[model samples]
Target: MEPDRDSFTSLEPGGDNAIAVTLGILGDEWNLWILRHAVEGAKRYGDWMREGAISNSVLSARLGALTDKGLFDRVQYAHRPDRYEYVLTRRGADIWTVLLTMWAWEQTWAPPATPPLPRMRHIGCGEFFSPATTCGECGAGVEAHDVVAELGPSGAWPRSVPASITRRRSAGAKQPSQVIPHTMELIGDRWSAAILGALFLGARRFGEFSERTSAPPTMVADRLARFVRLGAIDTEPNPDRPDWVSYRLTPKGVAFFPVVVFMITWGQRWFRAPEGPALIFTHRGTGHEFRPRLACDRCGEELTASAVSIEPVAD
Candidate 1:
């Protein structure tokens, strides 16, 4: 169901905070690509061009735009040659978590082979990693059907009922709740998901992101701004050039990488492409692929969307 835009309130009542800002920054494909490259250690424009073949104008614009949004730091590596490099800030590094999650999804659901890519394994145990949803608190596995979606404090709720619901009522169907909230809303857009995929592959510059996703510049800029506001990235001053800047993910942002890994896994399993995954992650210790699963830290149980419920604390 569509969210109630009227009732939804911003996490920051008056304005966007770090989280909102970061979200705005990473929301776009170009910005995301810039982040991706930074993650992969792309510092020079030449490096970005060689990797992605993006237009110079588009790349320049995206870099400048990301700098303005605080996602990138530009530093002059050579004054005489007028060469510069980009780097990620603490904030930018944080977004890796999100990228990891998306990668996991793509690997599982969108496999290049009919039998699917080789199974991911735990680096420590040498056990094949299986997809499981567990509770965040209890560590118990949860299923999609076990949890119910509800409107959160930050979301807009309907001031009035939608015409479709009202019409359904007229036809004798039960009127659903006035509010509905789900985790999917946090990362629902196809573009957003795809952008996260590119980031997982280490595309940190606009050109690289565009090359991977083929997204438009304007849209990429907008999304990158969202990610900035969301606190997913940090802009830093280039050490060599005080006037230039580079972008990176924050710790919080990096934590979201697991979400990307999960997404890739899902995509590979469910949505195969003519070609295989651009890249695959293997367990460094186990010599096996890593398939991430979400589980509750407290109980080690898998967490599913339907398995948990939230209640507001008393004021």
Candidate 2:
């Protein structure tokens, strides 16, 4: 019998252990907060609470949830008190690249003066770092608009397309969650994109996000929640205001910096004003402008959206 369409299928069926870690972790606000704290070295409960303004109940619940998911380990740090601290497991640390990318993105697009708390650096290079997205082949910069969608060689497609794209093109309906459709769904919405941009710029407060985007407070709240669920943003308690809350990017959220940086760089180059962008990024070490280009790391070839192919890895 044919399997149900909604049932999950592995990219590699029983070949390698490719767990659906993305879908599993991205489900709620607290989980995201736990991750953010873990990234910030908030292993102990007291340290986490001190680092952000999360409520005790919420923090407890999120810690438990993360521990349950195997992203964090609750190890006993105190003997008499029988206290535990949360630490990132290997699976958790693997997502750090994503966080660094997100931080780099915010530094570029959002307001430049007020950066997010706790900046990132490349430990290996010992320099304050901004992540760059070069082409996997060419190492040159590419923009989102420069990429166009086409049918894959395998003839696979996402299950659905946004209404706006469909209206723009007189093509037949396609499956949703296919590559192009999924891409649009991920980044097409202005509010969603704006929220991401703001987060990159260090606007974690509701009012700050709303002010930055000129979006409704309610909309910002909803989007923040959604981002939290997507493991893109973490919701935490406000440090100064006990009843209030704040948000920050998780490691997964930070990893998205490359995507944001690429898109914004593309926008600036293709859509900037005659006077140039309201903001620009510079390489801290070289004192040169950082205009990212996407090229393949191995082949040094520019990868257009159409030029790339996604093959399911063997399990």
lDDT of 2 by residue, 138-222 (tens): 3445433233222222111111111121112227632211112212223545456556656766677888877766767887877
Q: Choose the strongest candidate by lDDT.
A: 2
Model 2, position 156, has a per-residue lDDT of: 16
Candidate 2 Cα deviation (angstroms), residue 121: 30
How many clashing residue pairs appear in each of the predictions shown?
A: 146, 43
Task: List where candidate 1 sits over 4 angstroms from the true fold.
Answer: 1-13, 16-23, 111-154, 157-315
Model 1 C-alpha lDDT per residue in residues 1-315, reported as the tens digit of each score: 221222221222423222223334443445555565566677788867774546677678777766554446677889776888876644444454444344344444333432222233333333444444443333344442233222223212111011111011236432211111111222435344445545544556665556655567776666566667656656677676677554566554554555544443433332222233323545433444445456433444454423323122232
CA deviation > 4 Å runs, candidate 2: 1-177, 180-186, 295-315
TM-score of each: 0.40, 0.42
Cα error of candidate 2 at position 44, Å: 59
Q: Give all candidates' CA lDDT scores.
A: 0.45, 0.48
